[model samples]
Target: MANRHGPCMEKKCSWCCDPVKVPANFSDEKIPLDKEGKRIWRDREEIVVPESQMETVRLKTFDCDLLDTQTGKCSDYENRPEICRNTSCVDEKSTKSVDEQHRETLEEELIPLKGKK
Candidate 1:
């Protein structure tokens, strides 16, 4: 992965022009979730993660496993869309800080919103 793009990383993030992480898969798309505050890029045909990449996406939970070991591009680039082709990490906040950052993402979280569980 490091050799494919000769280190596909810089000192800044492609999006928001913020100094970000290693900068992998910065091309990921922005998907909107119907459940409110959740989303992911998907093909115009199937509005969901493909079965073949289900585990891969699930394992990435918060985009941890999306990092490519070769070109640093997403392992699923060929199957990705324009949105996924433009995603980037934040510069100063953890990806998990949806509240503090108030940013949107394609990922979802399980929480007791109304204390039902």
Candidate 2:
């Protein structure tokens, strides 16, 4: 389910701009769920961009592997991965602020880059 409050108020979320890998078969009709009615987990690959290739990495991208770049929206909003559906910056109860959480998550998932010019 997409955010009930509507599209995120933040300009954009880092995760949406650079999503992690998803299963090829991901879709609303075929989402994998566990016996407890929870979505199944899949391993995610790190997104790495060498310092030399920084220019090649698009910032504020909407071209996530699973998103519709033109609209800057998830291609499969109804059946998007649980993580995508659950993360929300607008929810005040959230411990870490949106920027903080996003940065932490990106740091963990994005591989360390080498020397920069």
Candidate 3:
């Protein structure tokens, strides 16, 4: 890929690249962390959801193999899978955890697009 230059790339955001879905009860501290304190999700660890069968919602997750941990970017973006291409980095879900100031900035950036068909 010749650097598509999407917003995500410009900001170097890679939050969704590593999708970990633990049970709601699982504590954040329990997640393994790297030396830099970044969460290191277990490879294909099966979590048990409450009030459901043991394997009701088993999420087999691990960081993408192509991700460049140092740069927080995909090494092979041009060859990224369909699922990656379909994800939206600008969605509410993606920004919910961002700090208020950044969120406000994002909202301001989007103001012009509001009410557009």
Question: What C-alpha lDDT values do all the predictions have?
Answer: 0.31, 0.45, 0.48
Better of 2 and 3 by TM-score: 3
Which ten contiguous residues of candidate 3 have the minimum total lDDT? 108-117
Candidate 1 lDDT, 32-96, residue by residue in tens:
23235444333222122324444333211133233354544454444543444344433244545
Q: Candidate 2: lDDT over CA atoms?
A: 0.45
Per-candidate clashes, comma-separated? 11, 0, 0
Cα lDDT tens digits, model 3, 8-109, are: 554665555644333334565665454576664544443323233333443334555567878778777666655566555344555354354344433432
Q: Best candidate per lDDT, number?
A: 3
TM-score for candidate 1, residues paired by index: 0.20
TM-score of each: 0.20, 0.34, 0.41
Model 3 residue 85 CA deviation in Å: 0.5
lDDT per residue, candidate 2, 23-84, as tens digits?
A: 33344344445457654333232334434345554211113455565666555666665656
**Candidate 3 at 10: error in angstroms?**
2.0
RMSD values, in order shown: 14.7, 10.1, 14.5
Give stretches of model 2 more than 4 Å off: 1-15, 19-64, 94-112, 115-117
